[model samples]
Target: MHIAPLSPDDPSELGGYELLGRIGQGGMGQVYLGESPGGEPAAVKVIKPSIVDSETRLRFAQEVEILKTIWGARIAALLDADPEADPPWLATEYVEGLDLSRHVASHGPLDALLTASLGATLAEALATVHKQGLLHRDLKPANVLLGPNGPKVIDFGLAVFAESSVSLTAANTVVGTPSCMPPEQANGEKPLTPAVDVYALGAVLLFASTGHAPYRADNIHLLFHQVVDASIAPDLSGAPEELVPLLTAMLAHRPQDRPALDDVIRRCRALIEARGLKVAQARRRLTNFTAAPAHVLDDLLAVDRPATPGSTARARAGAADVPPGQGESEPEMLAPEAAQQEPGGFRPDRQEPEPPHTPPMPPAPVPRPTDPRLLFARIDTPTPPPAGTTTDEAAVKPDRSRPSARPAPRGGTGTGGGSSAPRRSLRHSAQARITAQRLREAYAANSPF
Candidate 1:
């Protein structure tokens, strides 16, 4: 994922954590990279102001509750949250790795062994979630993070308690990616069960092996149709032989037909062991294939070096020499001119200076015209000609300065405002139109549209 610089609108601090930068944005809000007091990196998701209603707040609070109940190495543990805070936010352990979708797009689909490992890891993660009596509800490639340890499931924004009285998703409203959703979910069947996640895991595994979803379509409606169709088989042509049977069973149309999480885990492990590879070895291979380089973490944690005592003294003396209001918040390690020369640039062995505090200015009120008609009035004033030019000269003299009405020549400059060659003959124009029509017909016949 891309880490963007903090924008002016982004808060510098949230619930005692100092926000460093933006990680990404989602439907609910933005996820920012934050650092705790002890310098621990965290991923903080702040809800959007537009969604700060009572229902959304309750859902966010429920998400926090669901996250608190989940605990596993393959799960991103909830660190902190403030549902009551202005624009409620939740923080989770920042997994330093790319999401599974991005990983597959960058590198080709994982091999059989690695895919099996991912399946086992994610299955176990889902098992843990189910143990807490919660349904992930939205488990797809984008939600799974491939890190050093293994596959870690990250987002719980759409999770719900198995026995909760309140429903975050309204009746008959779909809530997940269509291609990865189970048949019942696509059909809006309730009440939902853990089997939905099992079916989604099957889709994820298919994507990991084939680099595309099982139910391929150009739009959501068709994809959802394919998912809900009991007779339509998933396209698993590219999946490994050992994985085909297990994936097929997991993606069964009926929820009861799908294997339990425990069975899924066992099948994945059996596939790995059958290939003369232990689960540990498979995990190491997965890490080697997907983990981010160590240098990336180093760069993320790097800080500016402290300045020398002599430079500090010189900088202080220079600051004292400057007049008040010339340069506010001048550093004690660099002169005002030098600092101004390079705004936000890294200086060797020097720490960056904090900006001086300024009083918040009240917003200026928008001024409304006393007469409403004046706002819609159009000004039609004409420009006065040059002093030497007369009105007749301006009127009679054709403005060669303006472009001609005719189309420009194919290869000649059109600035001279001269007409190009005469138009093509009627016969030739008719032939060109006929050729275009034929091409359009051919395209319409062959195109998916």
Candidate 2:
């Protein structure tokens, strides 16, 4: 919700739109608050040049085509786009409000009526996407904007052509946040169906109702396993009793077990009707509930420009009440290799303020070696003499007397290569023993023995 001032490196203009500031940093690009020539406010999302490869361009173009087909009140409409631009950029109606994730984090969880109304509107929006043969592969709470009008689902960066002919990302490349990922996605299933989004929406609604995802883990790898394992049921302890049954169906492990979008909308409507309110009345209630804080922003950006349709002026104001340093945490991106094996990692309910600029990807986790000898052998350290063996029996000194022979070829062993192999083996064995002893001592304090 915070609108950070544009940095020196950020372009002041893109595709003729005047860039105001940054709305938020995403995996593929930076979203800027921009003003069109006609004075209409737009959310301009430009692909980072560093990431603009041929495949990425193709994907962006496909997304543009998909967006062209999508039109819904609950979804942000695509305003303009230039897929052939230097880095390629697209603009959508800027929904000025807080993301559901940060809103729930700063304020407490929403009541049942509000949660049900949000779920129904979002489900209808997704239904439109599915009707066009598109799937919003990433549907977390952060992607839903609590705008002045109502909840509008934004960020289609991870959307995919759900039909048989197209695949946007590479094979086995895992995308989407860990906490909200469906079992099929977590297990690397291809040609995903609309049910994946249904499962994610369940996670989003759960967070809206209870302030946490169904699953939690110490690291991304463990979270992936929890999501994929059928034996592990989601922890639904804190969910509202009325909503638990619907959340359970939507969060089902198997795609077939989950309800279709229409069914989901039906159930959500039923919940609202039970509260003695029509769907429209409940939606207005939701709009009023979330829009209360946005009024404060009328003065903050008053001088920028008069409000237009879906202006970004209200975003910073709606989020103004969130205490400094209490914003939602940035999602963890799982590398391709990690995706196939461990899937991904995530933090639940933690707050990390968004950096003013996009941050570089963090280094991958270090692989733990199973064999100490293999680890020690890779390093060029000298091998010590073995226990109970004197230097005369074990030490092999390279002769400094002779002119040092030309360094060995890439894979060739040097002079005395055969002898060196045996010495190296002995050294590795000795080092392995020492490492084992040290490790045992270091862990002895916690050992049952």
Candidate 3:
């Protein structure tokens, strides 16, 4: 939502690369999209001149040293850096595709399989860093890039070591954002440990699967109190059921109670596979599929199910037809003939004709459901929390980041003596299944990086 004005620095003066545009800016510096000398896309973060004081200079040098050791780790790799220079810079491998924040907002919560895969990918990356005696202090959505390969963590500007008294703070430095920062950090606890990052990753995952932040507030003061109270339960209505336990483990109030990064990776990967989605390749297989289990959400059950069909062409087109110079030639050539009148039909041409430019067809309307459960059920994986661990909100931690309690199941209980929780009502059909498969193929082959 923030916009920035263009910087007029000469590209050649900085290095032998072309500057594309300014992408973002923060406390550290401005991030510009540029190309490497050899033509690789790169993101260059130029440190602000004011941070050249001895304190900021020393921290930048330390970052360079640590990053050089963990060069090719899962997230993004540092391509170049010059901590000694004025307006110091750290250029990293540029990742294409939307950030996790933008992607979720645009596409709805990702399908359960994709969400689970994201957790595994991140845990794996974090483990790599943790194993190297490094801790990624900033683990929020803006720092996690969603490339075609899956998710990759980036920006180690604020990362610290496993055991180092020299904190990254000096003179009123607020290390991280309030809503996602761990309770210890929010309480001015310096010399932060790895658990801080662990807790942050939990909040980020919650945001990825649900649209809201776990600890949002009007201001940082109240947000810090919420973190201290440990009162928030993530809004997990759309998250896979299997993820509930994993999230619980990650978001444990005490840092000592959180699972190691390795465990996090293993559990997330297991969830994805358990839901019948392949991690390596998610292409369509031998047959089309749908899951209409007996118990269903009231809204979903109310839907007038469309008959199974071999093609969606007879049903409706999804997007507006592109004109001649826009896409393939065939669709344009066929339009006039297809729009022509048939002989003995109830053609409204007899009464009056619509504007020739107007098409006879309207794009299929994708109506959003009122029920959040139905919307999230679009994701196929279930988030099965470990049996009998009460998720009561009132008994939250000293920090009160708990979300509101949802409505009880219909009739103040669920159907057939089953547990009183929402069940994902999957509504895949043959035609839609084929469409999804083709999309997967297109996504796989288009990995430019």
Residue 378 displacement in candidate 1 (angstroms): 77
Question: In candidate 3, how many Å is residue 331 off?
Answer: 10
lDDT value, residue 102 of candidate 1: 73
Q: On residues 1-449, what C-alpha lDDT tens digit does candidate 1 reach at each position?
A: 44556788889899988887777898889998888998777899999998789989998998898888899899998999999999899999988767888767755578788899899989998998899898888899999987656679988878877665456778777888888899887887667899989999999999998888888988888888888888999999888887899999999999999999999989999989998878977776676556542222233344322111112212222233334323222322211112223233222122333321221222233233333222111011013334687645544442334322223222221112222312222222222333345546656666777
Compared with the true structure, what per-residue lDDT tens digits does model 2 show for residues 1-449? 45556788999899889887777886789888888888788999999999999888988998788788888888899999999999799999988767888667655688898899999999999999898888998899989988868998887777887866356667777878989999998887877999999999999999999989989999999999999999999988789999999999999999999999999999999999998889987887677556422221222234322111111122222233334323222222221111112211211222322221223333233333444333332222224344575544432332223221111111112111111110112222223344456546546644668
- Candidate 3 — what's its lDDT? 0.54
Give the distance in Å from residue 184's predicted Cα in candidate 3 to where it truly belongs. Answer: 2.1
Global local distance difference test of model 1: 0.68
In candidate 3 the C-alpha lDDT for residue 203 amounts to 80
- Write down the TM-score for model 1: 0.66
Model 2: per-residue Cα lDDT at residue 110: 84
Query: Tens-digit lDDT track for model 3 on 1-449?
Result: 11122445523234544555566778877777666767676777777886677878888888787778774445687888888887777787776534666545543455455556667667778878888888888788878765534466877877878787577576556677776777777776667677887888888888877756667779877776777886665445665576778877888877888887778777776776776666543211100001111122222123322222212221111112222122111111111111222122111112211223322232233343333333222222112223453323212212223221221222211113322223222233233443355456555555565
Of candidates 2 and 1, the better by lDDT: 2
Error of 2 at 172 (Å): 1.9
> For each candidate, how many residue pairs have backbone atoms clashing (under 3 Å)?
0, 2, 20
The TM-scores of all predictions, comma-separated, are 0.66, 0.66, 0.61
Model 3 bad stretches (over 4 Å): 1-5, 9-13, 171-173, 231-238, 282-449
